[model samples]
Target chain A: MGDGPSNEKGAQIMSLFEVLTIIVPSTLLTAAPLIFTSLGGVFTERSGVVNIGLEGLMGVGAFTAAVSTLGLEHAGLGDASPWIAILFAAIAGGIFALIHAVVSITFRADQTVSGVALNFLAAGLTIFLVKMIYEGKGQTPYITHNIDKINIPLLSKIPVIGPIFFQQVTYTSYLAIFVSILVWYIIFKTPFGLRLRSVGEHPAAADTLGINVIRMRYIGVVLSGVFGGIGGAVYLVTITSNYNVSTIAGQGFLALAALVFGKWHPIGAMGASLFFGFAQALSITSQQIPYLDRLPSVIMLTAPYVLTLIVLTGFVGRAEAPKADGVPYIKGQR
Target chain B: MIKLVKKINWMTLLVPVISVILGLLCGAVIMLVIGYNPILAYQSIVESIFLQPYYTGETIRAMIPLVLAGLAVAFAFRTGLFNIGVEGQLMAGWLASVACAIVFGHLPRVILLPLSVLAGGAAGALWGYIPGLLKAKFKVHEVISTIMMNYIALYTTAYIIKNFLYTEGERTPTIPAAASLASPFLANLTQGSRLHWGFIVAIIAVVAMWFILWKTTKGYELRAVGFSPDASQYAGMNVSRNIILSLTISGIFAGLGGAMEGLGTYQYMTINSTFTGIGFNGIAVALLGLNTPIGVVLSGALFAGLQTGGLTMQSNAGVPVELIQIIIALIIFFVGSGYVIKWAMGRLTRKGHK
Candidate 1:
């Protein structure tokens, strides 16, 4: 009878260890892309331009990263190929986002409509290029050089914290977390951030202040593209390793959800992404866990979205977007 | 000539025309850059749709869902709501219709068929109602909520199909013929294509959308609310109810679109790992159609024809079918950015006057 209690305690400890080593690392890995993408969302929304095209932007990034990585690897660039591909992905995303910027900002088209078009363009253009490059194949060839997980040298020597946070974790995850802090500092601490916020909150006022509202909005949107591109590239390198129609399926939207759930704050976005990523990781790894395997897989799959809905319903709290978000900034117009 | 142009509402007609031309030109440029003969590809798409009776029928059949989906989107847009969940609602309808047909296989054809279709509409309405209700009661953004509902519908349907309705092919068993919308006469008329009675249903929906928005007091209220909710509320309109009603009506149209596929085109639902793209296409259709009833039909026909003909372009000219999607996207872009086109047209008219 006494031995039974000890054995039960031992099992509980083992599961705890498994969760830290397995689930925690995977959750961070999964959340890294969302963190990056939602941070991008934060920038655009803070600047008062609603970017529903983040999903498509991420798709462009994924495609660019996959294709460039494949080419670079073939050219014998070895381990450095994935990193270079990330740069190309960011550039491609920025260029693609320029279309949205011009249409929504310059032409003053409906932002939502323009974003939808951006998505369609990204999907079609990427798949068309994929087929053309791969000799009519619908997907890209698997990339050989993937972004592997690494251990922080001395930090990884710590017992529980090291295993959960430092060991066998993608550097991209750390980069994403670091970027979140940086974004926080930039958006909250800097004059540029204030100007971007002013443009979003009240473009007419910003214009009155001679802040160049349109220019600030443009920078905000393009920065989203850059971060979104990096998010997609990191996701491809770490998780998928190939570009297909469904590869970046809903991550961009999830990031958008994260942005909303995070209330458009950088650190909040990171936290929300981690939570959503935990839901995704749970679904993916549920089959291995003893009790969770009995739960329906659909529950896990739908958890992030359902939670977002609940959050939006103000059960948790209200999320108010920038006042001028999605509205075209007309000079001298209130 | 200036008087005639002014009287003709020329800008409305000119914008879509110029957009289409620009879209096609952009598509051609893409093909040229890729070292393909754009002329041959274009010719092939044209020939296939015109020369082949089967392709023409298939295109019309495809238009049924596209038209309904467009109406769904246009309807919501008229009410100042974006129903991005049409895809999800459609999925729910597709499954519900198929499941109803399968479960009620014993009912007479007359009763079963309409019931199955109505079941689909109701299912879709329920899916849409969640977002509408949330938006009405909690001030949640319809776009975000609808987007979330889509993933929920997708996962839930997939799970239900796998658990309860699994067949050998990872799909529901074929729905009963009693609940089918397949029309043998229409199929024979179209050279054995899968044309069905759903075309009639689609036509009715188009007329319904037009009549509701233009003729009904409720629709006036919805449109009023869309234009300015504060003014409408001040004018004694129930803005919240109108918002909910608009989305539910939108859901009905989207549901009918799904039923067209379930009853007429496929006769069953399959597990979809991703969106069917029809819902997103509906947004494109509604936008290009200028959110008008008549415009939707014409744009829907155009899109359906392009999709049907795209296969022939692939086979005949060795160009990928996704090029058509690119063209459609360009068309949407041009339409969204109509200001540039209008400005250019204004400059052209001024030069002509000089």
Candidate 2:
């Protein structure tokens, strides 16, 4: 009971609801970044553009958000102004997405390769800016607490579930969820959605239908960029609250998995993202449990990726991606 | 004639030139936004690393891994496989080479050096095969599987480094001078330069790969499979076997990269100390090279130059080394959308003819 492992074990085994209480909220919070990026990915893929640089775009968003958030605070707006940070992050993310759109839709470059380039460029640019400004201390000053967590008034009073699931979460998770719903509607319900999906499924056919594949893809990729930016900003403001190299870490890749495992469906991807988030939460939670606690930390870190692998192999059955997802559409292929 | 010349490969050169200029211009704009002297900074970047021979040698040291890693990815890319696992493969190669060097410290250089190099490559090949097997056998998606394998390789390598191999501060040892592939005579001939014969070896490897890729039956088979696996399978090519073979070849390239790092520079490998991300960077190398051996070498040099200059930019201009990573990411964006480029170029040439 005295040792760290024993106490950790005690915490791990306490009760079913206890695990859920800790897990549900953290999972949502963890899933928030993925949710935003997946929405971004879904946007592009549905419109027949595959944005692999969402990770890079997200990194850009995170770095810019951190700097601007800090800047805003210095300018006396205070760190509590997440609204301003989010706007700034959107611009940052948008800029990266615009670059992706130009190379991919306009230049007709390889979508996957372009995304990778964005990642490198963002990483280099962010690190350069951080170092040039912050002088290699590895990160920026932590965001003020006021700039972070906001508890809902009536929601907070709704018993155990409220505080655990709703109280502690950054507003980004809620925004991502709202956007996921909005994206679902936008991808499947509206006229723009139809054109986007049509372009994705068969660009030539869509072209015959008078749909502009390039324009749709550009919108899709740029939308992804916007969401990716929000994801990054949210990640920094809510989770890590400080900018560092490892701050973004492997979250981008995991989110990519979430997007894929969701089979490119907006709602389905939400479920997948939640699953990954829970896996991450469980990995941390297992630290307290005795039987699993004895396992190596490497095993713990490997768990989420392994789960992704399993999900990919299992549920990724017949993942009918957009026909033009990675294919650059030529006006006269025939 | 001028237009015809421009139509041939001029755009390939043109795009890169335009991209470089634009990328630099964007870089300058960002520098200004953040309040820095872009000209002085860029100048320092050009001078600080290139002007100094020692720095240039160190840059070459970095370029070795980039070149090999790029080859690994370039091999896979040409085979129609996107290998995200190069990072892990490279790490595995390092681990294997280090294990051989540490355990067989007394072996003569003539036999041991080659043996260690082979062992490193073999390890990476095995690691690389995991995804190939999964993709070929289980009908799994290669992209997801490769990414997962990367994690497995990284964690497995880290675990091995911690508990089994690199334990008790014995993770690194002073490599015997006998183990060095370089001669002191050659070192002196380079004017106190660390530019080892390894650079020469890398060049040779590139030329050899170019031969294998373009001048061999296996190369034809690989290219055919890459063109369309279903069609190749219909034509009696073993799709599964090719997938496995391509990955194995790719892994060998990565493994050799690790071996180079160990043999050429470190002379001994240390856990957690090998240049990480070089494998991932190899993908960038392949992209920049447009999936050719010569392209890989040139792109590797370009990247090497940027990486070298990036450090200087950090020290002098307050730019982050990670900015280079972002640039690489941007390049990947363009490369991934290669189809777009082909389309646009076609349109341009067609319009020109009209």
Query: Which predicted model would earn the best TM-score?
Result: 1
lDDT tens per residue, model 2, B232-255: 999999988888888888888888
Error of 2 at A305 (Å): 2.7
Could you tell me which 10 consecutive residues in candidate 1 chain A have the lowest summed lDDT? A325-334
Cα TM-score of candidate 2: 0.85
Best-fitting candidate, scored by lDDT: 1
Which sections of candidate 1 miss by over 4 Å? Answer: B1-8
Give the worst 10-residue stretch by lDDT in candidate 2 chain A. Answer: A311-320
- lDDT comparing candidate 1 with the true structure: 0.92
lDDT for each residue of candidate 1 in B23-119, tens digit (9 for 90 to 100): 9999899889889898999898888788888888999999999999999999999999989899999999899999999999999998999999999
Q: lDDT per residue, candidate 1, A252-300, as tens digits?
A: 9899999999998899999999999999989989888878999999998
lDDT per model vs. reference: 0.92, 0.75
| Model 2 spans with C-alpha error above 4 angstroms | A1-22, A131-138, A146-171, A314-318, B1-51, B104-111, B137-141, B167-201, B228-231, B267-275, B313-354
